[model samples]
Target: MPDGAPADTVTQLRRDLAAAYRLIAHFGMDDGIYTHISARLPDGPGGEKRFLLNPYGLRFDEVTAANLVTVDETGAVVDDPYGAGVNAAGFTIHSAVHMARHDAVCVLHTHTVAGVAVSSIKEGLLPLNQWSAQFFNRIAFHDYEGIALNLEERERIVADLGEKQVMLLRNHGTLLLGRSVAEAVKLALNLERSCKAQVAALGMGQTPIVLPDDVAEHTAGQYQKMYDKMEGAGGKDPEWDAFLRMLETAAPGYKG
Candidate 1:
């Protein structure tokens, strides 16, 4: 098994994850303490299937680097020493995505006002603009089944998501799964923007001209390619990694 990287590299990852928490909170993506965002740790030699997740009952705004729970696939706290625990719903939701979609190393779930508003709408998000067009033909819808605490829900959840990276949980919120932290965050950002656009457009009392299937497929293709390009270009991810640095300045002790 690879001994992983140096302590400095590991520390930077914690900060990046923390920064993501703050960024999501800044964007109002966090619904009190209801939703969750998680990242799968790199699976190297000697590594158990592990992940970093928000501590159970911690508000997003209150999250700290030290507080993030490191757990195995079964939601067991294998390495959390700072007393923070993983959110069970986060496990129930993210574990299914990770298992079914090997490419989804990150999963972001949000219950923002606009997202829920659009999800509750009969037509979910429509192709009202370029931003909304990003999800054009790439969105899935899952009906709400109360809080996601039941382990039995995993099968149905993955089935609902099938081959889609974006899902609109009716009466719940939206979820974005991706191959990396940045990709997942970008998807969530766009998904929120799409939901906001949908709610606002509907509120304007104007009929939305949904895009043609061909156009939607093309747009989704463009987006998928853009991510591929970013991956292929070999750029550094310190920006996200540096987020933890900011959190240390703002809210430390999550590392404790």
Candidate 2:
């Protein structure tokens, strides 16, 4: 085998991860050159651990299958053909979840306006809407400790996010983890929608209607069951195909 990933696996992972970046940009979830989404790479021929991430300094919309960089678990660029650098400073959070959560094959972090706004609120995300209800009693929160640059922060982050699908960084943004890129993207979209709806509701001055505990728990369970079904045999993800088509039309050659 070559020094890098097997061509077929690399090809599929690249397309899947690049599509996620484009979808994030398309839906206005990107924060310019900030934020990151990473996919775990199988151990290399030499038993080196690595992951795929966007090249540092590129806008999410500019990412393509070929431009994504491969980096070691420590955030060091390993075999990126373009010689692009890694975002070690920002990757602290990503590496933490990827290493701690074995099921987190794909990790996405975003700094969208709505997410940040909701994070600053004392109550965090509320079950004020169907979208928010899905996260009821299931989300985690981590206090903002300045920027996530230090490696020591990794332990704290992993401890805070234990077994949760989504995490809200206090006074910061949101983080989502999934077994695949498609699942993470879908969760990201829902979380952003939840935050946006909460922001809108809070501005109205009138008290927002919160679902009863039983109803919220029931709705959350239903949402989880739906996700499980989508991951089953003969089932399909609802957002992956739609976003792929969007990229095909607007960002042609994204898979290249």
Candidate 3:
């Protein structure tokens, strides 16, 4: 079930998770099916916490509801109809947040060009524009320790992320945590756009004026309020709904 709720929850989760994959692919965020977006399965086998993950070897655009598999906390497959199994390295980051932050229902990671470019920069994301201002004091940075494959790295990531909603995997990519798939998806989109804008602005060979601390903090606070309102109101996102409709035309059959 989506977020591991129960019964129909699985069906809805399957559809929404699949839709998320298609949407990521639609936005050119997916990197040859390498990155992952995981959701906690509340009704996992043995009453233990489990998660829904995309089976390895499948492109994001090829992900369908029926192809998603269930995995335990250790990246072991709890259930697999296709026998495609799981991605140990990819799950390392997701499992860390899932285990440490119970409030995070969805963990989305991406290896987009802009995301990786920004991650490699030392200054990280500058509060240059309104989009960038939204992340002021709301993002974390974790030093990359090579490819994430060990449990210790997971613990470090969790520690660095703390309570922030977004994180930049230094010299790597980006990580987003959300209480719902819609929230996570929206955050990822905004972060990507922010990075993309930063990179474009830098190309102009002129340092963009940074927002003052007071203005940046106030703008970020306003955005946080809107997010709180969305989360409180059942996490409904009109953008997600519009994306699903677009998926039906651009990449149909994700719901299957």
lDDT of 1: 0.77
In order of TM-score, best first, we have 3, 2, 1
Instruction: Tell me the tens digit of each residue's lDDT in model 1 across 1-256.
Output: 0146576756655655666677788677888877778777766467567778888777887776677878777788877755756666567888888767877767888889998889897888888777888888688888989988888888898999999889999998888987666778778888888888778777898777788878877887897887777655475555445654665676665454
Please give, for residues 2-109, the per-residue lDDT of candidate 3 as tens digits. Answer: 333557877787888888898899899999969999988775446677888999999999888899989888888988866889787789999899989988888999
List lDDT for all candidates, in order. Answer: 0.77, 0.88, 0.88
- lDDT for each residue of candidate 2 in 1-256, tens digit (9 for 90 to 100): 1246577976887899999999999999998899999998887778876788988889999898898998888888887765668778888999888878877879999999999999898899999989999999998999999989889989999999989989999999999998788889999999999999999998999999999989999999999998878867667986678788888898887788
Q: Arrange candidates by lDDT, highest first: which order?
A: 2, 3, 1
Candidate 1 at 117: error in angstroms?
Answer: 1.6
Candidate 2 ranges beyond 4 A from true positions:
1-6
**RMSD of each candidate?**
3.2, 2.3, 1.7
* Candidate 3 to native Cα RMSD, angstroms: 1.7
